[model samples]
Target: MATPGTLVLAGTPIGRVEDASPRLARELAEADVVAAEDTRRLKRLTTELGVTVGGRIVSYFEGNESQRTPALLEELEAGRRVLLVTDAGMPSVSDPGYRLVAAAVAADVPVTTVPGPSAVLAALAVSGLPVDRFCFEGFLPRKQGERARRLAALAGEERTMVFFEAPHRTEAALAAMAEAWGDDRAAAVCRELTKTHEEVRRGPLAELAAWASDGVRGEVTVVVAGAGPEPGVAADDDSLRAAVDEREAAGMTRKEAIVEVARSAGVPRRVVYNLVHSKGPR
Candidate 1:
């Protein structure tokens, strides 16, 4: 009988390589096999850290993930420790690793992690938005109509929203967000975070949209303020839905309209939300 090897999901620095942990270095040097999102990036990181990888290096990116997962899982079942690292951040975050992790878990292989810097948390921390609760909406749909529908669906999302966008699409994303979340809504655009030229532009969605219109660069993370209801507004079942529609048409977030309507009508936010969004007869 042999012990099943452990699978390590290691986190890498989003930008500044110095943020890589000592534990990551140790794991990189000692693992029996390494599955990297970008083998080239992993090479650079190892060179910078002055650590020579003793493991069998394997490419495991989105393109080859489905094909490569089984090979890695075989190593795990063979009692060979496998380490997984993405180009940046933890694996499985809009990145590779989920498939392999799932396979390993299903096989009852031990799974562990090496925590490191994360752009999501770093951006959220500096976003200046309410961080008590937040959701990570990884890259939006590229098409205009699809993106619009996605943003519209989240119109009632009150928890601060965090999104990753390409530099080229930053302007469009901001513009869509402004239309959906309202131009007056506060937001922060974080670019090249933790690296030289890192910039955090905080302002209303309209302002950010205009600023990005000139073009932006590097990795982009956009954080938007959550919608809250206005102080005075009324709500009945029909009125609630109507109120949200009116405010949304006027560029207020659906959640903001709901909150305002509930407060004025002396109703709970959830009750108001159900009335506004429920499809069946109320």
Candidate 2:
């Protein structure tokens, strides 16, 4: 039986090709097959790094990820060293590499990663928010209703939240965040990270939304402070159900509504859940 091959998930520079590491260049040149999210971007990266890759380069992007994962898996099972690189940051991170990596792992093929630049961490560091406990939310839903529900569920999250947004949608996203999380909620907008035009703006959510109204360009990362400790508001049973009902009416699942109410009311989730289900004394 032939030995299974290795699957290497190499992180690419989020911006500024100079950030590309020497090991990345070496791996790019040595891989048996190079799977890139954007082959053209990969070419540019290789050119900038002054490295030439002799391996076969294949396109593995979002549209083709499902269709191409099986073929990539075959390469791994055939004992070929396959390296995956996304357009920026790391593969499988709001990028196309998870399907192949998961397939490779399921088949017992060795999977490794070459850590490189990450927008999530970079934004978190520059956002000046509490990073000890933070959650990478990646990108929120594009649709207004879906995005609102998603944000509603996160209303009580106590950990710092990081989100990625497209240049065009940034203003709308900031507005939605301000509406859901509160106008005065502290947050930061990091744009064109690591690039020459890099900019980071820190202020309340409403302020950031207003600033973005003028238009934002380049890759954007948003970091928002988590909710402060529960207000322990002296809310009543009717008030709790009312809160849950309002969220449920806004497209959030009943369970999600319960959790949100519990969080914002400083009550236990189980208590809120039981109250809604009529299991607890009203």
Model number with the top lDDT: 2
Error of 1 at 158 (Å): 1.0
TM-score of each: 0.81, 0.81
Per-residue CA lDDT of model 1 for 1-282, tens digit only, reads 578999999999888888989999999999999999888999999999999999999999999999999999999999999999999998999899999999999999999999988889999999876788889999999999999999999898878889989999999999999888676677899999999999999877888999998999999999887676433443447767777778789988877877555544434567878876676643
TM-score of 1: 0.81
lDDT for position 65 in model 2: 97
Question: How high is the lDDT of residue 107 in model 2?
Answer: 96
